[model samples]
Target: MANSDSGASSNNYSFKVVLLGEGCVGKTSVVLRYVEDKFNERHLTTLQASFLNKKLNIAGRRINLAIWDTAGQERFHALGPIYYRMSNGAILVYDITDEDSFQKVKNWVKELKKMLGSDICLVIAGNKIDLEKQRNVPIEEAEEYAKTVGAKHFQTSAKLNKGIEEMFLDLSQRMIERAQENDLQKASELGRSSSMRRNVVVVDDEQAAETSTSKLTCCGSTT
Candidate 1:
């Protein structure tokens, strides 16, 4: 992808991004807010996974982001690794008003690092920012955690549409830059174990997408 300020030089890029957290953290709402610019107040649990294909023009590059929303129930927890397989990026979401959710997000960050390693563009989202009065996760605390984990943090409100755009855009831009720098290949080699090749998420797909726009999993293809 091109950086307007840095001089435009780019190609079509596609990335797989997964949303993760405890149930009711507004993972679904965040993705909907980005792709449809809408929010649902009534809670709906996602089963397995649901995805959206969003195309963006950033710095004159056509970037395709295949965003996945996964179920966060304890029973569904085992499916997380499957959903996150081969993901280029991940957003660890937590309800700002729920302290447990915040803790869960931290646990998830650790799990993701173990699974996807340091190559992924990790993001921390303090969702439900509209309910500032009910906030349980302090902004400073969250920002500090993000820094510790080397993740970019954002306070977002899917209902109010705050910080959602910038968060996703930043992830996309960084992903593009990583592809351009061939950083992902290095990251993948470092993270992947030869024994777990089949268990790994779609790392090859994302790497393949570095060249072919059509090779991207436009919707859901965790494995």
Candidate 2:
């Protein structure tokens, strides 16, 4: 088989993805839904920011995703660049019931583009589908904005655990493809080897257990 000749050609990719939205809009809930595979109705408002790390093996490539959840309060807005700098992707989330949150998501997308340029894999998520009856942001309108900004839009419900995985998986896959393209471009420009470095994998037993049971939070400071 032609696949046999490919051997075990595996490259590991570590991607940083930030979740940006207003407080009480379920940004933390969405992160927990993806990383812990559980939902909490009484989740406290996140003060500053935190992150969670998950590893996935896709087509012999190990993708280590660090999902950062940022505080959407305007006071903490200044700290955004601290987390999103060097990020490979970002998910601009908004509450379906809160029109204001959608507006905030728009501002975020604009800022990200101005600062990070067009390469940051972007996605817009209209969250809280479980409360669809209360939705104030129309799906068509959000989809149109997403298309205008060159990003994919998804309707998600952290409470019901809908569309959470698909959003993350799609973003991760896109990041991988983008990385491959950049690698190819650099190789052509520099006339250097097109090979990628091996990604070191390490996980301690206690850390792994904690990640499963504890809140999905990671690298960032509290306000």
Candidate 3:
């Protein structure tokens, strides 16, 4: 979700991203590690859905990410769209040790593409690379799937903080580029429409706000 409330005068580009996966795939762990730089040894459960706000300065752009962590239990599967709908990007996590979890990620990829179309950015994270000795999903297979679906694949470990930063950074940059392209297309369409009509039409300036670089901040909440 782009910041619908932001005006043309603002400089913040807000994007909503959702995390999806099976239980114990470490979706919340990944978010906590990236946003708060903290990791918990104990297992955590997300009830329905919760979101954390992360502010990032990527290539001189102030990107505000509302990273949503949703429950991965089968009971909560029905509520997936409520959290993911209108989201700009998605991180589908799967424990490398669990082959079933990887299958679940594929299901989500199909559902997201069917509902949101190809415009939504996707990242398939084979998490818990630290447990490589017990890995069940092959790295090459996962990469191939991601490539076929037009999504990026990564190996991430919240415990060791491996690949967390790089994955989010890559996703953020992708979203920014997509948003800019959308704005340009909208501007072009508006220009053509204006040329066709001689009368001046009042329009809401829905373009993205001005952007600037900023440091990441630990600001977030759970719902």
Clashing pairs in 2: 51-218
Between candidates 1 and 2, name the one with more favorable TM-score. Answer: 2
Write the residue-wise lDDT of candidate 3 on 79-140 in tens digits.
99899999999999999999999999999999999989977999999999999999999999
Q: Give the TM-score of candidate 2.
A: 0.81
RMSD of each: 18.0, 21.1, 18.3
lDDT of each: 0.85, 0.84, 0.89
Return the candidate ranking by TM-score, descending. 3, 2, 1
* TM-scores, each model vs. reference: 0.77, 0.81, 0.85
- Evaluate model 1: give its lDDT: 0.85
Which portions of model 2 miss their true places by more than 4 Å? Answer: 1-10, 192-223
User: Residues 1-223, candidate 1, lDDT per residue (tens digit)?
Assistant: 2221221244677788999999998999999999999888898889889999999988778888889999988899988898887888999999999999999988888898897787788899999988999988889999999999999999999999999999998999888776766644545665676648767666577677774654456433655
Model 3, C-alpha of 99: deviation from truth (Å): 0.5
lDDT by residue (36-128, candidate 2, tens digit) is 998988966877899999889887788888889998888999999998888889999899999999998989999999988977999999999
* Candidate number with greatest TM-score: 3
Candidate 1 least-lDDT 10 residues: 1-10
